[model samples]
Target: MPLLRARPALLYAAVSLACPEGALADEREEVRTVLFGSLDAGRSTFVSAGAKVAPGGIGRDGFVTLATLGYGLRPERDWWGDPRGKAGLTPPRTLRHTVQAGAVAGWQWVRDWGVAALFAGPEIAFEVLDSPGTRKLPTPRIGARVQGELWARPTETTLLTTTLIAGTARWSAWGRVSWGIRVPEWSAAYLGPEAALYADRTGYRKWSLGLHATDFAIARLSFRVSAGWVYEEQIRRPGAYGTLTAWLPL
Candidate 1:
């Protein structure tokens, strides 16, 4: 998916939101923070840090919020302006910097259902090329997401999320249906999948498919993986990426 190309962060969010759960209720308040960094084989590097503070488990009357910032050291810019095949041509230099901020707030119900609002804005700055004809450009996106859970259980959760974007420029509107499954308590594993569609002024903008997984490797350390595929017109880019995070509970 075009999104899979430049927006790996959202894919991480999908898995992060789906994987964690509560085993026993704790009366004391708790704060958990995670910091992680990754370098793709393509020579792009990223770093992000965030926290989740939940008074009542993350599923009940509390919120889960995170903010992430990253840049691509040698980014291929073909996926920027046009998702369709029309923009197949890539920029001369593969370097770009990106800044992103996002937040999500919600009221958890009975440890299963939830209502939340999500807002995110990302700005991109392309490195200038030597050739005047290859001058750089800027791209920014402002968007919001409204999500609600329809059914939830100790072992599974289902959510319907809708996203809208509007800014100094035009963007895409999309909706997603996501489902998660928890492994047997003794195993401590999680898996989730999501399907989404985007629409624009032209027509069906893009269709995306995503997957998430988490496994505990040792004490206070966990592994996370996510990947997605986006289809727009005759172009398709399926990207696979993820992160491994270690947690410190304070």
Candidate 2:
């Protein structure tokens, strides 16, 4: 997917205009850990765990870092085979394994009303095909990503967020806007619409509507459930997927 390539000057200008004075005073360092999983028909099962740390503390005004590792199990038919028929017929329903590692470094600014973050990083991925008579070598790819996020609270009970992500390996651009309603006891519900454009070996465009609910009943822990339907064009395949995630502060 193509990475979001908006000029950095514009992003900085937007942040300066939207944030108020109070946002800069209280910065502290923190850590967040997340575990998430998703499954889609005819696709694959995906699972990952990651952590983000602000070593200088939240209000310190420095760089934050993130690291994550993930694995995927895909159906055998999804594997690529030799086109000359020299590899013989394709194997039965087998499974392919993919492993990925990613890292990010970004600066964040916090204001009383909201926060803005900008980051750019590189990712490395490897895939292992498991088919009969196929070599077991891992295929590797390297890519870069640029992302930005903004959160604004226009009222005590309402919050708005926007996110943009772009990547070179897959050549895709994605953007999302969401509104959340904060209830008592730190619980919230949010609804968002997202759009993505991908240009790769097989190109496609996708639009999705998603809903998320979160509960912070336990100290330092949060649980979330989200679901969405994706309408895809180009290849003409539509799909739905749901995810469950847990957030822990460590």
Candidate 3:
């Protein structure tokens, strides 16, 4: 059980360390909006929506802007009781509800590189072990990202780009890289691999690898699909899943 619990914490920690420094970039002000949803093999579902509008890049030559907002909902429950069969063991674990809201902003030096700062408020709602009422516990989040483009090749209007990011969130640092395959059929793909360290005070680590696909159907609309795997080092519990994200550009 200790091994199973340690994995997620480590992955979350690594995610915190993979973003770039946005306060000091070179670019004009820009705004980006994103929304994502996911479900696991265990039937757990999660949803999130966020928007960011930056007014100016950090410095005079910065090419990116800074702005932020975020919200999320997720519920988790343990249907199977503890398998340990140890003394003083409790009954089944009830469902846990989580609501989160936050703000973040970042600047970019180019299309593929920049930095950002994230602030979040996460609330954990749960009922007393034996009681029926609910209680909400709020937690704070602070994140920093240092990201840059590692490779890019452009021929006329055709281009292929890859970017690397290291971000710090709470007490963990995460590393991720995104690959964009352009030209050919106007399609893009992203694969992100992340490792989390020192997550939730557990000495364990988690590894998560994800893939995303984007198809450009029109000038203003796109279709996206994604899949990923989450593995815990200590336990045999590994999560595998896929998802879809639709984007309409304004």
Instruction: Write down the TM-score of every candidate.
Output: 0.50, 0.66, 0.48
Best by TM-score: 2
Compose the digit string of candidate 1's lDDT tens values, residues 61-178: 4454444444433234343343443556643433434443344444433322333433344322223322334445644655543333333332222233333433222233445555
Q: Evaluate residue 238 in candidate 3 and report its C-alpha lDDT on the 0 to 100 scale.
A: 77
Q: What are the per-residue Cα lDDT tens digits for candidate 2 across 1-250?
A: 0011111111221211111111122212232222222232224455776665656654334676666677866453433454434467643555657676678779877565656788889987776667654666855888997777776666655556676767665455667666656554433333333333323332435566666543332454445455676655532566775555554444
Candidate 3 residue-wise lDDT at 176: 40
Ranking by lDDT: 2, 1, 3
Candidate 3 TM-score over all chains jointly: 0.48
lDDT of 3 by residue, 1-250 (tens): 3222211111111112111111121121222322222232222333444333323422222332212232322222232334433444443434434333333333333323222233232222222222133344434544554433322223222223333333344233333444433333333322333222212222334455676543433444344445677664433367764544443321
Clashing pairs in 1: 1-230, 1-237
Q: After superposition, how far is residue 74 of candidate 3 from its true place, in Å?
A: 6.6
Candidate with maximal lDDT? 2
Candidate 1 residue spans exceeding 4 A from truth: 1-15, 18-23, 32-48, 54-65, 72-96, 103-151, 154-177, 196-207, 215-217, 228-249
Models, CA RMSD each: 9.2, 8.5, 11.3
